[model samples]
Target: MIDKRLRVVLAEDSVVLRDGMVELLGARGCEVVAATGTAPELLAAVAAHRPDVAVVDIRMPPTHTDEGIRAAVDIRARTPEVGILVFSQHVETVWASRLLADGTAGVGYLLKERVARTSEFVDALRRVADGGTALDPAVVTQLLRGGQRHKVDALTPREYEVLELMAQGHSNRSIATLFAVSERAVEKHVAAVFAKFGLRATDTDNRRVKAVLTYLAESGS
Candidate 1:
């Protein structure tokens, strides 16, 4: 269950979609503090509202290409506290890599069409706002198909599935539910993933983030 209402700033060039998003978020117990149609407006709104999360489109305004992604990066540099979720119809691996280049916490990249279920979209947003990852399944597939297969090939089929879901930013509990397995099983798979990748145990290291980096590195994007 969600504990507190999340504040959001939405950016989309399409007025209809933007309005729909505002309404949808409101219905999901989120507060849409500001909504804009352009990148500049989005940056200004974010600065002014200091929202918990900013849902942005990849293409916006004049060029209709990469403006939203650029804005998201700017926000990450300026206000790392605010979560960013890039919602777009197009899946450009280069741009997606750019968005996640810094780190995964408080970041998400999801395809617009794939988010058919309202509950799923809200859950992703909630996860990002709370400083968790929420990558789209398509994003994960793209990475896996493009990434180096040698390391991934070593993983058992089930381990590969677990890694894929983990790369999609799902937590162990969520993954366990999806697989109809116990949390312990999910935990064991995660450990195996790290071990196969030769990740060292260190108090200062985040194995989850390291695993994601490995996926991206293999993807070469």
Candidate 2:
């Protein structure tokens, strides 16, 4: 459950879908600060509201091809604090990579049909709002398959497992629980994964994000 009420800006070209999402999010205790249909309107709404998160569709007005994702990228450039959740029917790996080019924090990409449950959607949104990732497993799989074979191959099986869970936005404690291991064990695995990826502690960079970035970059997705 979301610890705090979230203020959101929603962008979807389909009026029915947009309205439905507004109502659904409201029912789930989120305040829809603004709901828009076009990319321009979506950008304006986000700039005006500075919402906790923005739920965006990949297609929008005019061309309806990739305006939404473009707007999302722009939002990332101009308002890094606003979390973005790309909810689309299609999985555009190129668009996903572009959205996550700079960082993974406060980002999520989930296929609409795969969401299955409202609770899951809300949980993903909450995670993104809290500066965490919420990538779909399919997306993670594609990224993993595309990454540099040599780099990926260097990890031990356990380290690879930890990396996958990390990409899915699982905290060390959560990963530990899932593996039925101690948190310290999870941390060791995480550290091993980081070391294998050549990620080191830095004042200006988040090693975890960098590790995920390396995974995505090598994937060329």
| TM-score, every prediction | 0.71, 0.72
- Which regions of candidate 1 are displaced past 4 Å? 148-210, 213-221
Kindly list the per-residue Cα lDDT of model 1 for residues 1-221, writing each as its tens digit: 66799999999999998999899899889999999999999999999999999999999988999899899999998999999999989877666766676668789888988877999899989889988777775676674445444577678999889887776667899899999999999999989998998777886666676577566455532
Give candidate 2's root-mean-square deviation (CA, Å): 6.5
Give the C-alpha miss distance for residue 16 in model 2, angstroms. 0.8
lDDT of candidate 2 over 38-130, digit per residue (tens): 999999999899999999999888987898998999999899999999999876766676677666878998889888899999998998888
Report lDDT (Cα) of residue 168, candidate 1: 64
Assess the local accuracy of residue 147 in candidate 1 as a C-alpha lDDT between 0 and 100.
41
> What TM-score does model 2 achieve against the real structure?
0.72
Score each candidate by Cα lDDT: 0.84, 0.82
Error of 1 at 129 (Å): 0.6
Clashing pairs in model 2, backbone N/Cα/C closer than 3 A? none
lDDT, residue 41, model 1: 99
Model 1 TM-score is: 0.71
